[model samples]
Target: MVVALFNLVSALAGCVLLVVAGGDSVGMPNEWLARTPFPSWAWPGLILGVIVGGTQLVALIAQRRRYVLAWGPHAASGLVMMIWIFVEIAPLLVWSPLHGVYFLTELVQTVLAVLALGAWPQPFFARMPRRSRTGVGNTTDTPA
Candidate 1:
């Protein structure tokens, strides 16, 4: 649910950036995208944002293992947000108006991490949990 919302917002934000930011952060040449309507350079970053967000959302919904929630979109978002929170050196570093995007990304990332680490099926929402590997939940353990 959280990932989905984030992805949706990300996709929309991409559109906004593409249209508003122009070619400043698009990442691709205006001639490449061939859609003069948008700024052009902003395509790379904006497109990437959309792809990551969109895929993350799909991953969240399509997977059965609870771990995916942690490693999939949630993890991706968290990683990017974490970096943005610290570095603030992303492509859009030049854009002042959208600089707030970093904080917003960080927020979603934090939320997802909390859900996976504290909520999910137990440790490793995206990756595997330690207990599951040690067989602690099974009855094959020796009593101390």
Candidate 2:
């Protein structure tokens, strides 16, 4: 559910970016792309809407439908978000609080997806006590 909401927001934002031709409309300056390959916001906007947003859409659908290995798409979308931010900011050499916020959001998404994959001991939300695992918190067989 959390990932779905994030995906919706991201997709909407991306679509908006793609629709708007100028960076000024989005509070960005055309100068930012002076040192980069993009002559205008069109390419970035397309990439954001199609690549980043599309990935999120896929993740959301996979999760909602309970597809096989649904967590895989979630994890991939998280990585795509992170990479998109990095690539977007790297070329422009610009930074903003929004970037940090989105990066953290993606990080959380990735962690949650990993947790959903049953990477650790089983029954994460079970009411029963947690037992020790090899090389984990407690080595003993007793519950913690």
Best by lDDT: 2
Number of backbone-clashing residue pairs for each candidate, in the order shown? 13, 0
Highest TM-score: which candidate?
2
Q: How many clashes in candidate 1?
A: 13
In model 1, what is the error at residue 39, expressed in angstroms?
10
Q: State the C-alpha lDDT per candidate.
A: 0.53, 0.78
Q: For each candidate, what TM-score against the reference?
A: 0.42, 0.78
lDDT of 1 by residue, 29-97 (tens): 355444334444455456546654555565455444565444455656555544543443343233453
